[model samples]
Target: MTLLEVSDLRAGYGDLQILNGIDLSVNDGEYVTIIGPNGAGKSTLMDSIFGLTDHKGGTVSYDGEDITGLDTEECIRRGMNYVPQDDSIFPTLSVMENLKMGAYTESELSDEKLQDIYSRFPILEERTAQVAETMSGGQRQMLAIGRALISEPDLLILDEPSSGLAPHLVDELFDKIDEINADGTAILIVEQNAEEILNRADRGYLLTEGKMQREEGAEAMLADEEIRQEFLAG
Candidate 1:
């Protein structure tokens, strides 16, 4: 079943439009990745679906409900969680505090939920009391992802989750993400590192100038010479 769907989405920051009629979907327990360069509006499409941008047109449906133009809180209420590219964590907060904050909306945040996140990212459990900003870049990303998982969302949307990490750390992060998806949470991620992410994703979409240029199976896209030379070669 389709857990989330965005049809003919058109949105941007303000008067300036960034995404132009983008359509995307993530099925239950599926791992989907969107690839594009810096200015391809990949992030814009994410923001639009998560209700962070101006919705000029289109519909965003999640879990059989029409959530078009819904706010972030409503989006979360509908079983969707988002981790943005930057400033996802509170710099001054301790690791534990940051994780607790993720479930601020929950009336009864359980220890089991927290433990589940820690178990998924062991480094987060190891650095439980460390201040978020004091951790290394890779650790910080782990904390960010851990915080998002505290909500136990059905769909986790990640924007450039591996932007600043070293190549080795990026591989480690992707491994953790694979574990997350294997545990039954659907993933919709956007990244510039096309080949790396595509290798792990179930399906891949190539977006350019805010429009989807191609949608193909992850392995098939990686094997296509033209796609590799035109997009992944960068």
Candidate 2:
């Protein structure tokens, strides 16, 4: 089942077009990554789907319904959650408080659900009362992810999740993401860590200059000589 679909998507900030007829999709429980260099409009594509950009043209379908220009709140009601690269957590809030906010839309906040998130990131459990801003960068990222997971979203959209983490922490972050996908949540990520993310994703798309340049199985993209040299090579 196709969980999310974007067709001929053209979006950007007001009066400045960034994405040009982009097409992408994430099926139920699939792990999909978009890799591109800086200024390729990868992040714009994500914002467009999440309804944070100016929608010039295109159809964004979620769960078989058209959500082309739906607001972020409505998108969340439809079981889609987005964690932007910056300011993803409330700096002044405690770890538990941030997570509780994630479940604000729920009719009944389930303890079991909270437990699952804590289990996924034990550090969050340990620092439930710790102020979000006081934690290390990696721990803050974990808190952000744990908060997003509280709602049990069908699709979790992440932008550059490993951006500022230490090299060792990058692997740990990816491992947690893998665990999330394994537990049946679909992921749509735009990552700068090309080799790292593409190596783990089930499928990947190469976006360049606001357009999709290639789509292939994750391992295949890594193996392609052209892709390796042009995008993955040192």
Candidate 3:
């Protein structure tokens, strides 16, 4: 089932346009990645989906409901969550505090949800009282992801979750993402690490100049000589 669908999505910042009639979808429990060169509107696509950009045209549907132009809170209320590439966490808050803040929309923090997040990220549990600024980059990323998951979103949008992480930490972070998807949360990730992300994703979209160049199964895109030569850096 399609959990999120974006059609002819045109959005930008102020008068500057970025995405141009982009069409994309994420099926329930699927892992989808968007990859492209810098300034290709990859991140803009995420912003548009989360209603953070100026909506010029098109429709965004989630679970068969129209969500176009809805603010971030409305999107989150409708079982969607977004983690941007940077500045997603509160550096002054403790790990536990951040997780609790993620559940602010709820009447109260459910112990079950908190424990589930801790189970997925043990380091977070260990550092519950530690200030977020003191954590490692990978750990902070995990915390960001954990915070998103605290709401039990049906679809999770992640922008560059692996950015600035060590190679080994990137692998670990991807594994955690896989685990989260395995538990049935659909993921839409914008990533710069094309090779690693494509290897792990169920499908991938290659974007260039604010347009989708190709959308294909992960393995097929990885095997395409033209794609490797042009985008994957063969």
Global Cα lDDT for candidate 2: 0.91
Please give the distance, in angstroms, between residue 21's alpha carbon in candidate 1 and its true position after superposition.
0.8
In the range 17-70, model 3's lDDT, one tens digit per residue, is 998999999999999999889999998899899999999999999999999999
Q: Which stretches of candidate 1 lie over 4 Å from their true place?
A: none
Clash statistics: count for each candidate: 0, 0, 0
lDDT of 2 by residue, 1-234 (tens): 999999999999999999999889999999999987889998888889989999999899999999998998899999899988966899999988898988888775588988888889999989999999999889998988888887788999999998888898989999999999999999999887889898889999999999999989999999998888888864
* Best-matching candidate per TM-score: 3
User: How good is model 1 by TM-score?
Assistant: 0.97
- The candidate that wins on lDDT is 3
The TM-score between candidate 2 and the true structure equals 0.97
TM-score-best of 1 and 3: 3
| Reference-based lDDT, each prediction | 0.90, 0.91, 0.92
Give Cα distance to truth, residue 47, candidate 3, Å: 0.5
Between prediction 2 and prediction 3, the one with superior TM-score is 3
